[model samples]
Target: MEHEKRDHALLSASGANRWLACPPSAKLEEQFPDTTSDAAREGTLAHELAELKVRNYFYTTDFGKRKLNAAVKKLQKEDLWQDEMMGYTDQYLDYIRVVAMADRIQGTAEIEKRVDFGRWAPGGFGTADCLLLKGNQLHVIDFKYGKGVPVSAEENPQMMLYALGARDMYGILYHFDEFHLHIIQPRIDNVSEWTCTEEELLEFGSYVKERSALAIDGAGEFCPGESQCRFCRAKAVCRARAEENVRLAFSQDKGKLPPLISSEDAGRYLSLGEDVKKWLEDLKEWALGECLAGRPVLGWKAVEGRGSRDWIDMDAAFGKLAKSGLAEEAVLWEKKPLTLAQVEKLLGKKDFQDAVGEFVVKNPGKPALVKESDKSEAITNKVTAAEAFAEGGES
Candidate 1:
């Protein structure tokens, strides 16, 4: 797909996250242009399956309980509930009402025409997913399953953009007083929701259209924070990201910096360390690339640094042990793992004259997770058990 076309798809919260993090679209546009990852394909499949499951719950069963069971079963069959990593996400807030069936609205049964919500770019247009009627209100639901932070359906620019598109699409065919944007995050442990007035949606739509035009026509580039950069498609070529990687190599401890400014600001401030380290790595890459091209970095000083000691005196020590007629294994040197802090403290100790000593360290282990019962469960269980007894009217 063209970069512009892909950008429209990415306007959705999840889409933006994917573009910033993996930059698959930019990578495809650049080198090895027609490649796709299996992981990405699998993720799409999982979402399609999830949508089908939710649709079945509403359209198939009349009874709420039966619909729920059927929806759960359908989800299971689609392999959504089976794939441990793919199906179950740690971030899911809640599974509100799985396979929730909704009553159809009067005006939503008919299809709406596709209209240009607004111009994303000179030639680009933003479009809505679809408009469904649920009772008297016009329900607009957007599906998002990515691990990125979830976007609220209410007042979300993306949803507002879609609503604008829907308004243009419906035009004279239908009149919608209230616009509801429901965000379905099936991948999460908890389902989230957001709602907005039609007026709010219209205002958001206008704001984003102007913003989009500015972004596309504007000079320079979108220099979002590292978190936003995580999803940026131009990351490999992005100057900000290159600087971030360089800085990360130097600063292993994040807590050393002052907390006055945001960590992001601190990172930018620390970009100097990254620049130096990145320059070294770039030099190495250049040298290697040159050698491969039959041009070598001749006469370049290969500086040496102090490295770990060689066991040169070990043979003499072993020979002495043999001379003493004792086990050679007895003279073997063994080292133990130590934390950086522990090593530093030991180095300062006056009694530790020898540079070498065997040290052992082991973790105490994980703490157990047991909580006092609230008695709520016991009371509920007893009440339910008694109710069942009354219903049965038997022992």
Candidate 2:
């Protein structure tokens, strides 16, 4: 399948949450050149493969099958292609099939359908990965190929915008009453769905319109929260973000520092430390980039920091080592069993579970501090009497 170039709008649905919060960030991001990473390219291939599979499955023709086969062959030749991508894309297809079956009414699906929501967001348009229309219900399914973060459908601005765009394009023809938004992230095994009434969607549209107007003109205050700033191009040098972090660090009254931080204030600072740490890392990365580009960063200069040596031919090096008195098994190559995940992937999920599911045991994850909104259930920390006494030291 040939991939078509997509034109991004000023207020793109993918960056809706960012611009909706900090309307000025939309225009600010334009100053930086758009860059694509290897991971992003890999994701594009995954989506293309997924679309081809869906096309062949839904609209089966000899020509379509041939095209899909050709595309798959081409995809395999790509540098970023991985065997796991096939499994992940197949997982996505399975879920899509399940969704199609859930609705008793016969449905029609559109793959990579361009949707325009200009009614709410001015000139706002985006492509919905899959749009399944079943009588009065419309399903907007988005396939996320990245496994870095597990995205949720509930209150997601991107999915909401996609839903709005689908509604705008198909409302008259389908008479849709409810919109079901789905996020399928197969790599992380995250499948989430959120349902909302037409009225609710329209209400959110109104809010998007207000923000869109501001974003187009770059006319709002820069709100620098973690979610909005995470992907912002100008985040590295954004003054607002720096100011926010600075303010969080120092809570002084009238430019005078407090003698000591209270326990309550310490907890608050700890919560905000992650944001501060991220800002500092971004600042360092930006400074390094500037120095590397032959631009002086005041006190910073680009220099080789550290270096390491590696054998160019590992097998030859091992062969040379084996010629010596050292045993190959003991010094050259020590065999180790494959990881559980690797074994499962090799054997296939069902087959692996059937073979050793009873023997497999999953340990509880270590406790970690996270935001209140985290979906994971909280664990209580139990302090034993011995531990309390040890801390007190013979109290």
Best model per TM-score = 2
Looking at model 1, which ten-residue stretch has the lowest summed lDDT? 90-99
lDDT of 2 by residue, 1-395 (tens): 34446888888888898999999999999999777889889999999989988877778874387788898998899998887788888988998899999957799999988888888888888888899999999999999999887899998998889888887777778788988999999988889999999899889998998999999898999999988998888999999999999888775557766789897777777888778899999999999999988889997788998999998998888888889876888877878999999999888777899999999999998889777776779888888889889899963
lDDT of 1 at 22: 34
Q: What digit string (tens of lDDT, one per residue) describes model 1 on residues 1-395?
A: 11122443333433333332333333332432333455455455554444444444334454355664564565556433344423332121123132123442234421112335434313333433335654435656555556445455655555555566666666566666777776656544334456666677666656555555444333334443444544344444455556656555655555665647786775555653434554455556546656667775785534445789776797897788788887665545556798645763656333333543435345555544222322122222245777788899965
lDDT (Cα) of model 2: 0.87
Question: TM-score of each candidate?
Answer: 0.46, 0.87
- Collision count of model 2: 0
- Show model 1 residue runs off by greater than 4 Å: 1-36, 54-116, 119-130, 147-151, 218-221, 240-395
